[model samples]
Target: MATVWSVTSPHPVHPLAWLAPHAARRRAAGLRRELRPRAADEPLLDLAGNDYLGLATDPRVIDGAVRAARTWGAGATGSRLVTGTTALHAELEAELAAFTGAEAALVFSSGYAANLGVLTALSGPDALIVSDAANHASLVDACRLSRARVVVVPHDDPDAVDAALAARTEARALVVTESVNSVDGGLAPLHALHGVCRGHGTLLVVDEAHGLGVVGPGGRGLLAEAGLAGADDVVATVTLSKALGSQGGAVLAPAAVVAHLVDTARSFIFDTGLAPASAGAALAALRVLGDEPRRPDAVLRAAAALAAAAGVPAPPSAVVAVVLGEPDVAVAAARRCAERGLRVGCFRPPSVPEGTSRLRLTARATLTEADVALVRGVLAEVLTLVAAP
Candidate 1:
C-alpha cells in the first residue's frame, strides 16, 4: 500500500505530491494515456472511430458545414440563452425530432452535456434512478450528479430494472441505459425495459449515442426500431458526432420534457450552444441518410464481415470488440495493426472491465472490399501475436 502524510500531521506533504503515486500506479499498470494527436494526412486506414455512416469526409457534409460557418461565423458566441441558438440549431432540432419520430428535440454542445442536462433536469428530491452497470461513462456521470437515489443493475437485464423500479420508495423513478453499450457491441432490451417503465410508471432514458444512424430502418435509431419513438415515457439522447459525423448532441422526447429542459438543465442553459457548422453538417447528413436509405445496412454488413474475420460473433452495431485479457496484449495488438498501416482502437483499464481490455474496431459504410481484406489480414496477424507465448 502507498503511504502518504496527512494534511493535519506535523509534516504534511505538498498538495500535488499525492498525484505522483497515482501516476506511478497507472504507469505500472499500463493504464496511463497519452493524448496523442494524429496528422490529417496520416497514411493509415481507420477502424477506430464512431463514424458509422462515413459522412465525416462526405463532400455534401463538408459543404454544409462550410456554408454554415461562412453564414453564422465559427462559434456559437455564447450560451443558447444569450447570443447562441441560431436558426440552424432550431432547424437541426426539428429535423432530428421528425426523422426519429419524436414529438420534440433539444440540441446541446456535446453528447456528454445532453446526458447531464436531461438527468439533472428531470431528477430532484423524490426521484429514483436505476442505471445499467455497463452504461456509458457519460450516463454514469449524469447518474452520480443527479442527486437522486441511484441503483446500478445488471447489464441488459430487464428483470433487474423492473425489480429496482418496483422496489424504489420514490414515486418518480427513471431507468437509464445505453441502447448499445460502448465497450462491446451488446444491446440493451429497450422494448422490454420500456414495458417495465410503463408498468411501474417510470421514465426510461436511453442513450442512443451508439445506435442512431446505425441501427434502425433508414437509421432513425434503436427507439424507432423498437416502436418506442414518440412514446410518452421514453426519452432518448444521441450524439451527432457518431453516425451523423458531426460535433454535437440532442435529446429526443415529448414537448413537455423538452420545454422543461430548456427552462432548467443547467448544462444546456450555461454551456455554449452547438456550433452552427455542426448543426448544418448534421442536418445535411440526416438528409443524405434519408436520400441513401441503404447506409445503415451497409454499416451492419461491414460490421458482420469484420466480426467474421476476427472470429467473433456478429455484433448488433458498428462496434466489433476484440477482447484481449491484458492491457499489454491489447496495446501490442493495436501497435501491430498500426505498423501494417491500419489504425484500430485500444481500450484498456478503466475504459472497460478489469479483465476486458480490447480493440474496439468500428466498421463504416464506406469500407470497400479491398479495405476489408486489408483489415482482416492485419487483425489476423494481431490475434496471432496476442496468442503467442
Candidate 2:
C-alpha cells in the first residue's frame, strides 16, 4: 500500500545542485572529509586518539562501566536540574574536585559544553573576554556566544593578554586560554598569564583539556602545576575523555561560582546529564590513576621517545607533533604512515590556527617501546617519501 500527502513548495530546487559546488571546491582543495569505519577487533597502531593514559580500554574502567549500566541503566533520562542527577554524578563531581584541588566542580556532557556553560553563564555584553588566538574551537565558540567584547591576543603572550585586559577598564574582564594547545602541542605560560590576570583583576579561565593527566604532580594538571588551582579568581575546565580516559567534562571553581553555574549555566540546566556508565568509568579511572601514580610519567616518556626518534621536540603534554609545512605533504605523509599499519592524526587548516600543517601524534601509557620504534620507523619512511626530490 502507498499513501502520500504533499504540500506545495515555494520555489524549485535541485537536491544535488547546491551540494555539487561545495563538493567540487573541497575536492579541488583536498579538504573533503570522509568517514572511515574501524572494526572492534581491527589491527592498527593507534596514535590519533586523545587517550593519553590509555585508561579507556583498561579492564577496571570497562568493569566500572558495565557495573554502572547494570545498576543505573544506560541513560540519565532528563536534564540534571530535573531528574538526571544521580549518586554516581555526585560521587564523580566530589572526586574530581578533590583530585584537582578545586573547591567545587560541576560535570557536563562534554568539555565543549562545559566551556560553553562557563563562558556564557559568566560573561555578557558588559564583560570583556581576552582570549589566546590559538584557543580551542569550543572556547572560541563560547566567546562568540557570550555576546561579550572579545579581544584575541597573540598566542601564549602574557603581555598581549595584559594589554588587552588593561584596555578594557570599564568592563568585567576574563582571560581565556588553553594550558596545552591541541594542534601544535605548545604549552602556555600559565604562571605568567596568571600573574597578569591577577594584576588586572581579571578572572583567569584555563582550559586544561590537553594538560590534565599529562602534567603536574600525578597528572593534577597545569593549573595545579602553576600553583593556581583553587584560587578565588581562577577556574579550570577539563575533559574526562582524555586523561581520565572516559567521558564528560567539568568546570572547577570556588563553591560560590559553582553555585552560580548550577543556577545559570544553560548547558547544564537544559542538556541531559552525562551517562551513568561514563561517570562510573571516569570515577574508576581517576581512582586507578591516584593509586598508580606513574601512569602519567609513562605516557610522557613514550611521547619523548617518539619525538627524540623523529628528531622533533616532545610536546609539553602527551601530544608529539611533527611539522610538515605543506598541507598536501602532511596529508600524504599521514596516509603513508597509515598504509604501513600505523594510525596518526593529520592536522591542517582550519584546525591549525597558525596556518601551518603537521601530523599530530598522541602518546599513550599503553604504548610499548616496540610500538614507539615501529611508529618512528613508519613516520621516518613516510616523511622520506613525501619530501621533495
Q: Write the per-residue lDDT of candidate 2 for residues 300-326, one digit (tens) a residue.
A: 899898788677887678888888877
lDDT of each: 0.92, 0.89
Best by TM-score: 1
Q: How accurate is candidate 2 locally (lDDT)?
A: 0.89
Q: Candidate 1: where is the Cα deviation over 4 Å? A: 1-9
Clashes of 1: 0
Q: How well does candidate 2 match the true structure in TM-score terms?
A: 0.95
**Count of backbone clashes, every candidate in sequence:** 0, 0
Task: Tally clashing residue pairs in candidate 2.
Answer: 0
Clashing pairs in 2: none
* RMSD of model 2 against the true structure: 2.4
TM-score per candidate: 0.97, 0.95
